[model samples]
Target: MDFNFTEEQDMVRDGLSRMVREQYGPEERRQLIASDAGWSKAIWGQLAELGILGMSFSEEDGGFGGGAIDSMVIMEEFGKGLVVEPFVPTVVCAGGFLKHAGTAAQKEEHIGGIVSGERVFAFAYAEPRGRYDLANIETTAKKDGGDYVLNGHKAVVIGAPWASHLVVTARTGGERTDAQGISVFVVDKSADGIVTRDYATVDGRRASEVYFENVRVPADALIGEEGNALPLIERVTDEAIAAQCAEACGAMKVAHAMTLDYAKQRKQFGVPIASFQVLQHRMVDMYTEYECSVSMTYLATLRLDADERTRKEAVSAAKVRVAQAAHHVGQEAIQIHGGNGMTDEYAIGHYFKRLTIFDSEFGNIDHHMKRHIALAS
Candidate 1:
């Protein structure tokens, strides 16, 4: 029932906050994003040195044996810093799948590299037609001699530009959109017949439209049992949703604080706008939304180990609330900063753009609302 972080968790949180504050200021982040890789490998290595790259795994997997709460702490700080690193794609999404479904040898081979920050991974699950449905896979995987051949196209694969490996979903049995036939595979990024069209996204991150034409991998590339990856995929996706909600909370907190400070400084009618009753009321509303979002994020994270239904329901609820708060806080931040907020030179507009990306990723407000309603029914 207690929501307060334990000493260890607090330590990790504070350490990560201090590291980000000292290293990833707005100007530094801008320079990093403008670089060719669109992210900082130096910062990524520092995170590994700090043991944050391993926070989501267990001790046996070369991690600190932390859980969702630990991941939330690190991700919240990453969000605050507007990190362009592919931590979520590599450590959260791909690593979750590996930890839950990979063989022991697979774990050692893939997860070891992940924990050391030597390898980056992208979840190549999204298809051109797939919009939030985890089971909607159109890519086909067929049995070959001691291997599987994959052929399909994945859309908007975030982090693919920097990824050395990919966790891809394909149809091994049933029709597209059917849950019974999906499977997941670990594919090398430089494999033959693989073509990637990479570009920078609106939020200062990179993504790729990846095409697979007769891509072949050994049978050992399978993550878990064949034709039974739906359950695992769904579970990992839910974890990602929870993490995204937490990150959104962090971004919203920054946006709210920035807006308040701007209000206090920007004078109108010979007085600070923050002194105006209307602006004060708006700030109060932003704070209320942020606090509510924090409570919901914690509730969802605490419920991750509960029954599947309970956990998913809580995640959907938290995502819904977080999405609402993100929109409200992002817009208000921009409004408070006036025309200057729309410029790329200011950090507030960038925060708003990141919030907008968060709102659309995994699932949006309306998507989670429908999901929550379904769970309630």
Candidate 2:
């Protein structure tokens, strides 16, 4: 199968690439993350103007009618600049849910704001006790008169502080950890009885520990059928994993490039360190890992529409390889950069931190390895 991008896809990538180079330099990104908002609303508006926020939705949903490959293109660029925006949360995760299963009214109400960049969304799914298990929900949504009252805490909700709404998961009927009874809702973040304690993460993005205390949402807020949303959740998350793997590939590419440039510039024994054959071999190894990751990411993204078992197996397998590449490239970049790489002022270290945290997102290396094994079985 052909892996080349279409002309439109190439155009979107080149435009976004130029935008990242001009607008989000390393210094600009560093400062943006340091600010209280921890991201740039101005840049978000720029993305809206460029029609990126809507790139992955259907035309009926006020989008340009893009798909997972579109998201992969956009996210790879976002990763290069280490953008701290809520693209993954708002566009990939929440948008995936709406595009796949939302009611017409839900799409009409939410997708417009999202495409226009007037709204941001965070995915509040993982609990303090839930370690990578999508069905392990301790939060509950109980049926009330014409509404569902949500009560539970979501831990490490990425981008929550900046979100206007949340795509949240909760148990609606069956016991915790059961595949049945897990439901999803679109909740207004500022609703009564909702609380958030936000902080900066090691990777320069923001996250929150969010609590829902008797927060009532209209029945219309439900994204899919109650107690039967796990399959939908899995599908969306697999799509997300594809996008995220592309992002990691972008990060690895930049990290390896930076190390190569540093080696060419830094001198030892009156010659560039790059002149040394041993270091050259290491750099080559890093490049190889990055390329391998790119191929695996492509595999995952392409297989998203396959059967459930096929899709899950491909995503998990890709994630395992990509995570390993991220770790190897990140460590090598730092090692090649030596003492300077360890400084917070340098951008390579920041890249390293992002790559490190990337391993834990969606699922870790071991987690995906086990998942792939289970699918194989």
Best-performing candidate as measured by TM-score: 2
Where does candidate 1 stray beyond 4 Å?
none
Estimate the overall C-alpha local distance difference test score of candidate 1.
Answer: 0.90
lDDT of 1 by residue, 137-242 (tens): 8899999999999999999999999999999999999888898988999999999999999999999999999999999999999999999999888888888888
Candidate 2 on 1-377: residue-level lDDT in tens?
99999898999999999999998888988889988789989999999999999988889789998999999999999889898899999999999999889999999999999999999999999899889999999999999999999999999999999999999999999999999999999999999999999999999999999999999999999998999999999999999889999999999999999999999999999999999999999999999999999999999999999999999999999999999999999999999999999998899999999999998988899989999999899
Per-model TM-score on C-alpha atoms: 0.98, 0.99
Worst 10 residues of 1 by lDDT: 359-368
Stretches > 4 Å off in candidate 2: none
The lDDT of model 2 is: 0.94
Q: Model 2: how far is 88 from its true place, Å?
A: 0.7
lDDT of 1 at 91: 90
